[model samples]
Target: MYDPAYGATDADLITFMGEEVREESAALGRRWFLVAELAGRRFPEMVGRQMYCADSISSVAAEISPVLNISHSRAVWQVETAITLRDRHPQVFKRLCRGLIDYRMVSMIVARTDNVADDVMVELDEAMAGRVEKWMKLSKNKLRDRIDLFIAEFDPAAVRVPPDADKHRYIDIDPGDTAGTAFVSGRLHAEDGAALDQRLDALADTVCSNDPRTKSQRRADACGPLARGEATLACQCGLDDCPARANRAAANAAVIHVLAEQGTIAGTSDKPGYLPGFGVLPAQSVRNLLPAAQTKPVTVPTADTAAQTGYRPNATLTEFLRWRDLTCRWPGCDKPVQRCDIDHTVPWPYGPTHPSNTKHYCRIHHITKTFNTGAGGFTDEQLPDGTIVLTAPTGHTYRSQAHGASMFPALRQPTGTVETTPLPPESPDRIAMMPRRRQTREQDRRERIATERRKRTEIITEQQRQHQAWLAATYEPPPF
Candidate 1:
C-alpha cells in the first residue's frame, strides 16, 4: 500500500494541512447549501404564519438537530446562516464552495449584514466576495471590523450593534462531580461585577498576612462574610494584635473607568464607549454611567506628544494607549488593559517610552516576553500604528492590530517616532525571575475540592437536622 505522507517534508506537511482545512471548509459550505435547499422546501408551509414563518423553520431545525447531532438552537442558527448566505450573498456562497472563506467567517458576515436591504445585499455580496479571501489571517476583532466597515459605509442603518447583555443577567450553581460540592457561575453587568470584585478584595485583605490560606482561598472565604452583610472577614492569625484586623475599614467604593468621545458623553453622538475590563457599552449605557461617574477630560495623544523621556507613560499617553490598544496586544489574548501591564516592546532605556515602542501585555505575557527572548524564544515587534507581530519558537508569526483602533478610527493615528538602540546581548548566568507558587497546582486543586466538599456536607447536615425538628414538632395522629 502506498503512503504519500511517509516521506513528506515539513513544508509538504504544512501545505497538506492547509489543503485539508480548505477541503473541510468547502464540505461545510456544501452542507449549508443542502440545508438551505431542504429549508426552501418548507417555505410554502411557513407562509402566513402567526410569527412570520418562525414555527415552520423551528420545526425544520428540530428535525435536523437530531440527525446532525447538534442542539436545536444551534441547528436553527445554522439554518438562518445557510438561508442568508444562499439567498442574499450568493457570490460569497460561491467563494465558500471554492474554499476561499470558512463557515465561521461566513456566519459573522451573515449576522452583521443581516439588516441590509434586499437591493443593498446584492452590492454587499459582490463587494465582500472580492475582499474576504484576503482576510484569512485576520484576528476575530479585525475580521469583524472589516465586515462592519463595509456595512457601515454602505448601509449605516444596517450596521448591527451587539445586544445589551445586562438584559440577560443570570447566575447558576451546578452540582459538581463530588457529591457535596457545587460550582457557581454568573453573568452580571460590568458595574456590578466591578463592585463585587472590590468588596471581595477588601474582605480578603482583612485577614492578617500570617493567615495560612492563599490569597485566592482568602477571597473565596471572604464571600461568606460578604453574603452575611459583615463589614470585615475574621482574621485567622492567632496573634491578639493582628494589624490587618485593627486597620480594616469598610470596603472602598468601586470605580469603573469608561472611555468615550465628548460627543458620546453629551446627547449628540451615539458612538459607543469602551469599558476597560468588560467590553463596548452602548451610547445610552455610557450616559447612564455619567451620573455616578467622576468625569475627567483625558488628552488624546498626538504624534508629537506621545513620547516621554521617563520610564512610565504620562497620564495623557496612558489614556491614549488604553483607548488604542484596549486589550493586551498579544495575538488571541483579550485581557483588558485594566488588568494588563504596559510593556516596552523594545525594552525601555534602549527604546524610548513611547506608544510606538510600547503596548499592553498581561502580567503572564509580560513575563513571557521578558524571559523568553533570542534563539528558541518568542520574539515581538511593534509597528507605529500599534500593530504587534509575534513570532513563536515554532517560527509561526501572528500579527495583531490595536483592537480599539478598529472601532474608533481616530486611535489608528501614528504616534511620535523614537530612536532605539539595539538590545544588549543576553547574559548566560542571568536567571529568569518567574513567580513560584506556594503549592503545586494539583495540591491546590485537591485542597479546594476538599474544602468545598466539607462545607457542602455541613450545609446538608444542618438542613436535614432542621427538617427533622420540624417533623417532630408538627407530628399529629390522624383523626380517623
Candidate 2:
C-alpha cells in the first residue's frame, strides 16, 4: 500500500499517530453509544413489523447482528453496558462520547462504581467533570483509589457491607505437574487469616546465615513444612548450621479468637460479632468457635472512663484496640494492626487517646494523615458506629465502614447442593450457521456491517424453514 505518512518528519508522524489513536478511541466510544441507541430505535420497529419470533431484547439483539454484520453477543454487551454507564455517570459518559476520554477510562468508571447505589453514582458522575484531566495523570491504581474515595464519601452503603464470606471464599490448588509442586490459595475470614499470616512471618524469619533467598522466597519455602508439621525451615544458603529457628510456642499458638458481643454470647439476642482481620460473622459462627477457643477478656474503655485517664490508653486498652482493629483504619488498607502505628484522628494531645478518638494507621497512611493538608489532602470525621467518613481538600467525601457490625446475623448456615440439570438440545430452527465470507475492513468487522448481508439473508431464510418444520413437528402449547 502506498503511504503518504511515510514522507513526513518523525516528530510530525509521532504527533499525528498519537492524535489519531486518541480520536479513534473516542470514535469507538461514540460508536458503542450509538450501538445502544440503534438497538433501542430498531427494537420497536422490529416489534411493529413482527419480524422477530419474540419481542424481547434478546430477539431484537439477534436481528441487529445480521443487519449490522456484527456478533449478536457483542451488540448485546455494548448496549447493556453503555446504557448502564449512561444512567450511572452521564457526565463521564458524555465526555467519553465526545472523545474526551477513552473506552478504558469509561471501563474504570464502571468498575469503581460497581455495587454503588444509583443516587451516589449520579453524585460521583457530577463530581468527575472538572477534575478528569487531573485524574488522567494518575496511574490506574491511583485512579481507582480516587473513585473509591468518591464512593466512600458519597455512598458509604456499598462499602459498609463487607463482601459475603460464603460467596467470596474458595480454595484453589494449581498443580505444576512436571515441576512437582502445587500453588494453593483461597479466602479465609480475617481472624483466621491473621493467624496464618503471622505463622508464615515467623517461619519466614527463620533464615540460616548467608541466606540468599528473598523474604518472599523464604515465605514460599516455609509454607510446605508448616503445613506438613515439620519444624525445620532450613534455607538453601549452603550453611552447615543455621540458628534463626522461630520459637515453636509462639508459632503454634495460632488460633481463632472472636470477640462476640456479650449479649450474643449469652444468647439473649443475635448480635453480629467480629473476627479481627476477618469480618462480621453470624452469632452462630461466633457461638460455634467459642466452645473451642481460649478466652482472654480485655476491657474496652468507655468514653467517661477513657477521659479520666488523661486520654492515654493503658496496656489493657491498647490490647483491646489491637484486637478490635485487626488492620489499618484507612478504608481498604489491610496492614496488620500489630505492626501499625496507633494514630489519633484528631491529632493528640488535642484529641483524646480514648478508643473513640484513636485509630490504627500503617506508617504510609499515618504520614498521609499528618502531612496531607489543604484541599487535596485528606481529613476525616468518625461516626459513633465507628464509620469514618474522610473528606478530600476538594470536598469530596469517602468513608471506611466498621466491619463486624452486622445488624442481622445469619444464624442458620446455608445448605444446598448445586443442581445440574441438562438443557434440552437446540432445534434446527434455533441454530444459525453463518456462511463463509471474505475478510473486510476492521471497522466493518466491529460494526458487523459488511457486503455479506445479502448473501447472509439467504442463509437466514433457509434456517427459518428448518425452524418452522421443527415447530410443526415438536411444538407443544402448555395446558392451562
Tens digit of lDDT per residue, candidate 1, span 147-215?
Answer: 989986777656664555776799876545543234678999889999999999988888878988888
Per-model TM against the reference: 0.43, 0.34
Best by TM-score: 1
Regions of model 1 farther than 4 Å from truth: 1-5, 48-54, 162-191, 202-210, 224-480
Each prediction's Cα lDDT score? 0.75, 0.59
- The Cα error of candidate 1 at residue 38, in Å, is 1.7
Worst lDDT 10-window in candidate 2: 411-420
Segments of candidate 2 deviating more than 4 angstroms: 1-252, 267-272, 282-284, 308-312, 323-327, 332-336, 374-376, 383-387, 399-401, 404-480
Q: Across residues 329-440, which tens digit of lDDT does each residue of candidate 2 receive?
A: 6654565676688887665665556566666776645654554433334677665444567665446566665332223222111111112234343344331222212432
